[model samples]
Target: MGGIDREKVKGSFHRQAKTYDQYARVQKRVVANLLDQVRKEVGTPGRILDVGCGTGKLLAELHRLHPEAQLFGADLALGMCITAGAHLAAGAFVTADAESLPFIDGAFNLVTSTSTYQWLPALDHAFAEARRVLAPGGIFLFALFGERTLFELKDAHYQALKREGEVEDITHRFFPPSRVEAALAGAGFDQWRVESTLEVELHADVPALLKSLKKIGAGNASPRASAGLYGRKRMLAMMDIYQEKYGTTDGIPATYEVIYGAGRCP
Candidate 1:
């Protein structure tokens, strides 16, 4: 939390907002599961808050499920907020930081986030904020990428870098399920449950896969700007290394470790 630069992170998402939907297939799938779990936990919430609600895809679905309930969407990206506003059904769309929500305490009956919490610098504070904004007995449901996500690619990248006599961490940052569960508990939430799942997909090559990740702005998060680090030579090297190590009988594979969790505010 202390090391976070909120403005930089927000700007990063804003820059990629226009193309986010194109590469959000993985996110969409995870969010669908999160929604199903939320439905099971609470039949129909009277009011819902969609935190980090990227292009409002999940919000659109929620609107369909509970047409009468008040809905609100919040994200750090202004462009995403505008895009979501155009598609969502008469709901308020605000460009706001998830760590410090601009709402009164107990403002929502249910809070949901998808593929967004991993971007936060402080999961603990974010969980506290989620709990703070929810009414008593409200449900908080979210899906986030975990440490196991992109393990193959990360290992390949590291190995390649080591071969080139470079020591670099190309892995995306995310908390494990146990840490996430502890954060929720420390934030004073009750009835918490969390689980992890590995979702894998095949790609023709690393470039195709990297393009998909870039389109969603889900690339490296080292705060070291992509323009310089993601040059042609480095990219080609990464592809070659990935093919050499992880290519399967079908094609090159990518795995995403998706962590889903829900907690109730008591």
Candidate 2:
């Protein structure tokens, strides 16, 4: 695969603007954890920039914590920007890409994101942008899905395809902690630390899980992904495989490997 189709990804989030927060349970948890970590590692930020600030959720929390600080949000999707701007009267929202921010060097004292970077195929440019936009001693706090995230779903789909005499790998790949560390080092971000945590969400079944992902604008936007993933036969096969392999009496579990990291500008 060349890389994630950014336009498609933008469209995905744009289409889900109305329902994003309703279905973003995992995202809410991740950002809450991100905020807690931010409070622990950094002092009062003068100017904060939130990358991929979908619907201003993180910005809202930051505003709640630091009412005196300035807030700004950036998202590639115009719909998301508009949605975020609607409720956040205190912050400025802009349509911009994470790989190439429109801000000046050292424009922000704190940069934050959550449940965003996993969509990018590579991290060099995005990480560099985060580092570039941070002032000296500023901190970058972020949480992204790690490689182990959604393993059961990937495994089930692979087995479903294999049983049907097909061979393909269409699921989107998430970066591991090592790659994240490497990207931060490459970006010249100093005093960095990264950790992985497992967070599991229980869904009614495969279809429900798929719907949750779609509603949250987390659909697989990989160029190599095909319609076969949702085919009736393949989907049903996947459901059975998933239930038999990873299900519990409570419900079917969807595992998310959340990788949280923080770095300071030297």
Each prediction's Cα RMSD? Answer: 2.0, 1.3
Candidate 2 lDDT, 1-266, residue by residue in tens = 23687877899999999899998888899988998897888789999999999999999999999999999999988999999999899999999999999999999999999888888879899999999999999999999999888899999988998998888676778998999989988889879889999999999887889899889888787886665476787889989999999888888988899999888999
Displacement of the residue 101 alpha carbon in candidate 1, Å: 0.3
Residue 1 in model 2: lDDT = 22
lDDT of 1: 0.83
RMSD of 1: 2.0
**Candidate 2 wrong stretches, greater than 4 Å:** 228-230
Clashes of 2: 0
With a 3 Å backbone cut-off (N, CA, C), the pairs that clash in candidate 1 are none
lDDT of each: 0.83, 0.90
Model 1: residues with Cα > 4 Å off, grouped in runs: 1-5, 170-172, 225-231
